[model samples]
Target: MAKDYSLMEDSNRSSNRSIHDISDPSRRIVLRGGLGMAIGRLLAPVAAGSAGCASGARGDGPLLGFSSVPVSTADKVVVPEGYIAQVIAAWGEPVGLYGETPAFKFDGSNSAAEQEAQMGMHHDGMHFYAQDGSRSGLLVMNHEYADDGLLHADGMKTWTAEKVRKSQAAHGVSVIEVEQQGDDGWQVVRPSPWARRITACTPMSFGGPAAGHALLRTAADPAGRRPLGTLSNCGSGITPWGTYLTCEENFSSYFNGPEKPSPHERRWGLRKGGAGCRWHEFDERFDATRHPNEPNRFGWIVEIDPFDPGSTPVKRTALGRATHEGATVAVTRDGRAVVYMGEDARFEYIYKFVSREKIKPRGLRENAQLLDHGTLYVARFDADGRGRWIALGHGQGPLTAENGFADQGEVLVKTRQASDLLGATKMDRPEWIAVGPDGWVYCTLTNNSNRGTQGEGVDAANPRRNNTTGHILRWKEEGDVDGTRFRWTHFVLAGDPANERVEAQGNIKGDAFGCPDGLWADGRGVLWVQTDMSPSAMGKGDLTRLGNNAMLAADPHTGEIRRFLVGPVGCEVTGATGTPDGRTLFVNIQHPGERPSGRSDPEQPGRYSNWPDARAGGRPRSATVVIRKADGGPIGT
Candidate 1:
């Protein structure tokens, strides 16, 4: 039977779970862009509903090349008949460091020093960047968090300074150099100068209006311009200009707030006691009462330079903060850079940032400043397939002193407040979004069990009740992507193919999926969807036939979805990307055998999933897997 949903879930635990805490005022702001005018753009509807997958035609990409694999409760990775998967990097694999590299310890005895140069835990969103024209490249990945039971020799029940430090070193991003080995395999380039790890202890700086804001001040950096690290990074994106965008989600649970919580802090899920991870017990900075503004420093989209590991990662503030899922870049016809983002909490809003200046392709440094100044907007979706982007800038409307927004900096720091006042449409837990080749946007509303039954009921956009299965939403800008108006529709109401709800909406043919989380569109207009379903639901109910969390391929044009690969037991399929040539595919299998009722006592054998190891007494580890066809053909062809 499924566990009581509310009791089994903590504020710290959610789909793609990451945590932090905070509090603020409830003042309202004005909406600058007229919603009435925005509706006019959608009146003339177009026929482009789902993505156009060119692969269906002759001489295009492959046409669902392999048969669908059956659902299994086995502890092994499963793929279509012609495809093969190989593990590349795991939790403790050493990449490279300032000094010498150390070997990974399977006994969980590796010191904090070793972890600095090793791959972090809970591999999440990632992207592959070709460096040597597809022969070799950099694979940038996010380490969501560490599993206390597996990270420590004796578990988190008896925490110490070293254990805390080791965990901290395991919660950021990894940029490792990978080179092709054989026709369909790749290996990590160990000790390569290009391989490096950015942990929660790495030094980082801030950019945009909120860089020097008072809310960001801390004893270590009174200027409030620099923060010590990044944590709770969930989903991510790769920018057109070559930087990696790693989003900080659910950061509110990181801080242990004051004795009396403020309304804002409560809303952000700040707890009086330390967060579940208990980092505050070792580092006072995590205690919000001691460092009141520390929690404010997180919850922003951080950009990292994969090619230059020595360069500092930056928290881009022009894109307002919340529980940021990630940021996707879309370039307009005139060269402007537009970023679409989703705040990943239930009822949170979707947002976008339009750069003030056009993109400069001269050099990285020449174009780095483009993201420093942009107009941020919150989305408001209507029941009639229309939507508007409300400007979140200062001097726009009611964003004055009366509304608690002193300036643009204040508006960004309190982004959720600003959007609430503007009446932005509340969405289900929105996660990663993909932009098809034709410019239509596809987003994953990864379920919202907390939704009420009435006004927020089944509408043209979010059409479901107690949406445990979730759905995919798509929209297109009538003119410029930065324009205030757009047309929207429900592309797929994800669920069992046999069910009436899914049959009436979803365009699935081969394999069906639920709780779509990580979404990306390859250059060929194929939409890749990754699943993140609850462990109990994996083999029961409408999802019983779906087996483990798997990655599916969907033709944007026909809306046909086919299961491409299924992960090991207890794993969440996320962090998917392919090489520039599309011959090699990289997908992360996170927290395999992480079932809520699974064994966790180290003294016992096969405590969870043996996974990639497939041994009788092996422990589960989150690792990045490489997938390719046996014939060395392009993936998902």
Candidate 2:
């Protein structure tokens, strides 16, 4: 018989699992052009709902540990009464003495050089280093993107040269030393020696299939060996050898291009005619002429050695570049590392990279280089629990010149195109994916809001969209991550049971959730479900804007999805990892309030997301939340 996981699940994971922690108070502030509209845009909806939740508790429902509630008001975590959480690091902690973060100069005036020393905003995905904090390993996190005009001193100005340059630098990753402060909490070690920032200017090398290809060569990199910038660093992965791998998401939108591009550019959806991001106006490097092969260089999984500050990060091209949302890896039973990845755009495809050489956990050197050479494959799943991994091999199979696909090299260079050639099912905006130690791989089909309408399809994988309340897909690798086939199923459809949309997806039969974005299975195999992109209240079909975003733990065996903790208004829950002991769970909350949607108050002056800051009222900060069991035991029901 299968192991009865429910017996091993944390008891009452639901008690402290739910709490009412919503609070609303308008703070007078300055506005950046885009952020000034937040009040008017949200006041009628969000603030109104928050007001209702504050008017006193309606029935919290059963203590099945399933209710999702707002953050605690007592300056501590508010879970179902059985769980607890604490603040680990906030924005602007003394991370590597960037001189006290220079007050998040939101204006686009800061130079690229200065921005590198400061922590990037909107920290999304992060990983806790198994190595001791003192031993060089640090928590490496993706800053995603500097939201609105935050991260600048006088507020973003002119979106000009210096400002754009500053924006670029503020978009990578921050590595900081953190250690357990107690049985269940973690804190950053000030002035950490291992703390470092990987910005757009950081020196990096290329790896994998397209490392030195002609497509990757730019005027600045004639040899096609080095790429200077990294942008839109989204979710990430950590190899068994202990290096951090961050992927670039939405890179296609960064550059502006022609309606229909050349074959190569079209493979990745770039316009053949021009540059994107308007960075060309201020910096020639952004121009294709100056860097003809530049665009092809991004969209690959870039690896950073957190253990070596001086090491040059490597972009593993073999993984195939696209709008890489995130990378998650599982060590197959045979010791090879299988990296699970996604392309985070509507109708994008999911991918996996399996190394030819088996992984040795202690072989840091080999493991570090393992991602350099590999065969990348995209995924196609069926609702009935079975699927196939059609190989988009380089010169292999039907991917040949005769059939319109020229070669393996071309396949690597034009990944999406190759996946299309092989009939890889177009998926909902696939995001972060995680593999459980028990050998089950779980993925989040973030949302396919525009799939069908945009000439995309209702594929077996991405079944629905505006799919306001997304679902979680899970599969078990057949023998290994490299297997050509597997079993799959929609594990959970997110929504609120009390709401009508919940009934629409049939999740009301179990649990109602919205936008299942982040998926992480603990060492003991408890899956954590996080919500994002919940639609506007009401019109949301069966889904409603119940709360900002939240984190929940699910017992795969029992079908029980209990709410963990909800975030403040206008934020997304992302980037999760646990201390080795599993008692402390670290979570990232990003872009609270999106800075009021437009305008700037001249007096206060910071446009957008005053959260995690004092001026925005409350903490007004974007910080990582740490949760633990009250008894200091492993959590996740």
Candidate 3:
């Protein structure tokens, strides 16, 4: 999740078609009747529907029974000889909600009201709800931005307003309440009432159809339906009526713009001395030239009920916003809901929404406005493996009002300019979106060194042209999740299939990884995968043989891929979850002493990783970790 590239907003000039033009050799022998029988007819109906998937394995032989764990330029956390791990919840700890649990003072002096009761900073995408079931409940997560040199003390030299309210109380979302403690394992149920946090100032509201539009009016929420917080809170989702969705990535690097910045704030990268989190020098409402609609109220998809700790977080915005990178709900077999998103950067796209209403067996108060009424769609992919979703509604076609889209809340606050005027299919940076319990959906695309550069070439599902090792894109929808047509492939392509540079040689069949950011697919479908690889590109070049950043599991019915965990030095094996009896898994790890100039030198704060408190000079927090199976069996077995 470190591919900001100064918010590379796609300027898309239409002309779609490129999934390598289906490798044209007559559409590659009629749409790949080759590449291993086109990935065995795209995973043989997900391994012949694995006996109706989802039940935590065991009647299996090889769904990845834990063995693979190699690549490790260590610093700690490796797991896989009957796994163990530990460290439950980290960053500035103590998310005891109002009972105040503070206590995480490892030198960065912790206070902006004790980091708003702690725990926020770099841990991305999460979700593990349960209740009294799987040992306990509610983990929630996604505090996706804030490194500010190990979050201040003398770090940004002395920035004021209390280091901009402790870096806006370390950017949004946390929740807490965990349990499972028989063998002294998962803990954190601190002042539990579903121990909330939700920061970046936490006030939130805004629901669908661009909430109160007028480009989300703001001179301090002019009825633009609130929106005071939730910044780059990356990848997350849970909802089958339970709640918690998160998303909202690279929130235009937290405002500041306006030295001639308007083309919708330069298509959302804002600019004019921002992106460094000075929080527009002590929050003048982040000064987008004096709060110009506060960065259009943050790239959305909020939701959040976590057992209603006084619920409010909303921002659904009909699921349109870009830079989202998460949001994977699914339901529709006639219940409606759908979701599925992704739009990390470099030539963005890939979206979904569907929910016009239907999910009701009495949950979250009759599905409280079920995602504020949906129908977003944006994909396009066709070169013949098929795809097409389009829609972005407002007068349909060119999203009219003469192409400026005057309704549907300005086509959802210009969702990437209405998917670049509905031409879509521009990816290679689309972060997370899971699904697969045989319904197949997946997506990661996490690498794009500006694909083949100059105007970003190389396509056909982003066919590596400088892609720096990254792949994984599945699909299926031809009928269910409110189908709009689908059928795609390439489930794995991440690097080091012995690279000598054949686009960084990837086709991973065993253990070789690079940049395939956090993804999920649990409930027995395996497919964990996590990886981010960017403490200034770890060891350098083709990601220096993919070491540190790790977490893998994949088995979408025998496509086998393992490497169950590795992560420490300058970390980022991002948010994963478990424990609906999958016997505990958690994961997270984020900025462990992140240097290579991505901030942190608070006077040698554990150089490049002191992970989970390696003591001696402290300061490298961004925790979570948990993992189990020291015979308590279940995770990836």
Candidate 4:
């Protein structure tokens, strides 16, 4: 089927580690009449237009910018002077009833039942809300995804019905309340009420185009209004109303799609690849012929009320389902919620959804419905760095075509088909999204096949070929979310190391690294740039050698990218979150140096990334790393 994946890439999926390789592991804009004050918050002499950064300067800690470093190697975390990193949480760390992460080993034979209680693997896309700005609260994060036996006792293969249950439990999200003791500290809050898991086994509600649609029904969810689990909960955002919004990235892989679907079944772009059916080895739910509606239940944005853990999670159908990467929330000129999303895939598309209602504020009832009603749009960014949101509403744009969409519900259920119907600009694999507090939305156009001089032309928005190296784009919405228009600009272009030569002009001597992903904006507007270490990029001497994927703080106003932290070998700096006080920075080091497993005998390798435990001799557990200033000062510097 024809497709448009631009909205949010359900990228870096599939037996991850293989895809999560930071070295090549994969994976925005502002509007406003304001005079760039977000970028103006700093004294950036080199990077001038930088209005979006956390002001990385402090009294006398690590110097600001990417000028200094500790070492070189794709297996270590690098940071400016004065900063130290500590692993906060890692895979197998217990969080539920059984305690102590359930008995575990890095084998695929693990029963899904055991998968619960333990922390999920390959932690990515995360956010931090300071429960007690001074010390502790909760750290909400996404496991993004899991690898084969990589995260299980056996792996994806040895998954028994019991194992599937645990895997389901392990696939969603983890929340932990924590407290800082002193200079170098942090400990779990031993199970606070807000602490709960929203795994693939948890109950979730549907509220969009596909909701209650007969096509979405399954033996488990015969009513079609609910889904048993949510796999691929990737990058995410916190709503203005204080709820946690989790994205469903690469959710398509969890179901089974036949080589060809019958007339009544859904046919995604996967048919071109053929030979599917991995989940079939285990359950009938994976059988498309028997469960045509299964896959549709996924690929939509999910929202969970963190404060009230018992609330049923809602999937905003208005957003239009596809391989949703992550979403950022913005307030329209009229005050409605505008969510920007990207579908991470080569030649895919970008999208936006403006809620029918406005997000009034924290603790407001209307804010909850803000995402229930709205219009969805696909993006088309031109070479001049300008773009527009193509309306996909009923009777507008592609939805007007005479297909099967007789109403708004149909338009939404077949959102992806509609986007394809409209000629949306296919972009580089897009990932992790962040909207600045100042009204600008930014997305990481990870990379694409430029077709160099061949096929895929290098457009202005995506200016590179096979764009191994990526760039960040920021756009300002027209008037507001429902305006039907928007302006765009390339906020930053990721490049190789300083001494590297550009495919064109000057020796792009700067720290413009490759494949941008995992983005989040702080209270002060500092843009944190994290790089996915590509094998070639890591081995490229100094040009783009990030040791591993490094997290850099950039001044969007001045366009200066500074390396803040580096991950270990075979790992990516997938998720980074911080306290409002800006004292502690929590980062997830996922699947570092996974011992290069051989596909032949999948379970032979006995090594794993045992992070945080700091106890693991070398085995690195996909874990969360905590960074703080040596002297107990604010962390941004």
What are the TM-scores, per candidate, against the unseen true structure? 0.88, 0.80, 0.33, 0.83
Best by TM-score: 1
Residue-wise C-alpha lDDT for candidate 3, range 1-637, written one tens digit per residue: 2433333454444555434434222222112121111111212322212111244433547667778888888898888898788897888888877668878888888778988888888888887777798898888888888877777767888788988888877878888888887878879877887787878888878877788888888877787998888888888877666777888877776777887887767776677776666678777888888778778788888888888888888888988877787887666655666777888876678888888877776678888888898798988886667787888899988888887888998888888887777777777778887775445677888787766664555554444767777787777777666778887877777888666777677767678888888887666667688888777777778888787888888776656688888888878888887766677888888887688655777888788778777889787888888888888888878
- What's model 1's lDDT at 348? 78
Model 1 lDDT tens row, 168-272? 898899999999976547988877888888888899999999999988889989999989899888989766567788999878766788778775566566777
A best-first ranking of the candidates according to their TM-score comes to: 1, 4, 2, 3
* Residue-pair clashes, model 4: 92
Cα lDDT for residue 108, model 2? 33
Top lDDT hit: 3
- Please say which candidate is ahead in lDDT: 2 or 3: 3
TM-score computed on alpha carbons, candidate 3: 0.33
As for lDDT, the candidate ahead, 1 or 3, is 3
